[model samples]
Target: MYEIIFNLHSFLAYIVLAILGIALINAILGLTGKKDFTLEKDFRISLFALILSHLQLLVGLVLYFVSARGFSAIQEFGMGGLTSAARLLAVEHPFINILALVFITIGWSKHKNLMEASRKFKTIAIFYGIGLLLILSRLPWSQWF
Candidate 1:
């Protein structure tokens, strides 16, 4: 179960990052060109990113409960026993990833309430950009790649 969830989490991370990058670039182009926010493309891209990110969050949550590097590490080590890598997997990665999702959610919600294309683009750019940065910062890059 742990291996399955972990693999799912890892696989989904790539999808989430790709969607986010596409959304971010689209948002930037919309903002810079002062173009209309079309429902067909812009909205769909952002929505896809949002959905993929949420799925990742759910997978990570499950992995946390079942993986030895997750809750079990905390149980066995009592916090101090967690090596830096263990702590990254059990705490930092999950927590920051959730935070990134929150920011993405906020961006999606805020964009819906806005009527102006520029405003919507700005909201997405700021929120999604921040979320992307946070996720990148916490990724177990060394372990993952």
Candidate 2:
């Protein structure tokens, strides 16, 4: 069960990263080009990114409970005994990821209220960009490669 959930969480991370990257690029282009925020493309891209990220959050939560490097490490080590690697997986990764999701969610909600294309693009660009950066900062890059 642990292995399965871990694998699923790892696999879903790719999807979440890819979608967020594409969404960020799209938002940048929309903002720079001053393009209209069309429902067909912009909306779909943002919505897809949002949904995939939420799914990843759910999977990550499950993995946190079941993975050895997650809750168990913290429970056993109390906090200080956790090696850098263990700390990354057990605490930093999850915490930063949750924060990224918060930024993404705020971006999505804010864009909906904006009537101007520039404002919508700006909201998504700023919020999603920050979220993407946060996720990148804490990813287990060594393990991933």
Residue-pair clashes per prediction, in order, are 0, 0
Model 1 alpha-carbon drift over 4 Å, by segment: none
| Candidate 1 local lDDT, residue 15 | 91
Error of 1 at 16 (Å): 0.5
The global C-alpha lDDT for each of the candidates, from Candidate 1 onward, is 0.92, 0.94
TM-score of candidate 1 on Cα atoms, chains taken together: 0.97
Q: How does residue 90 of candidate 2 score in lDDT?
A: 96
**lDDT score at residue 8, model 2, on the 0-100 scale:** 90
What is candidate 2's TM-score against the reference? 0.97
What global local distance difference test value does model 2 have? 0.94
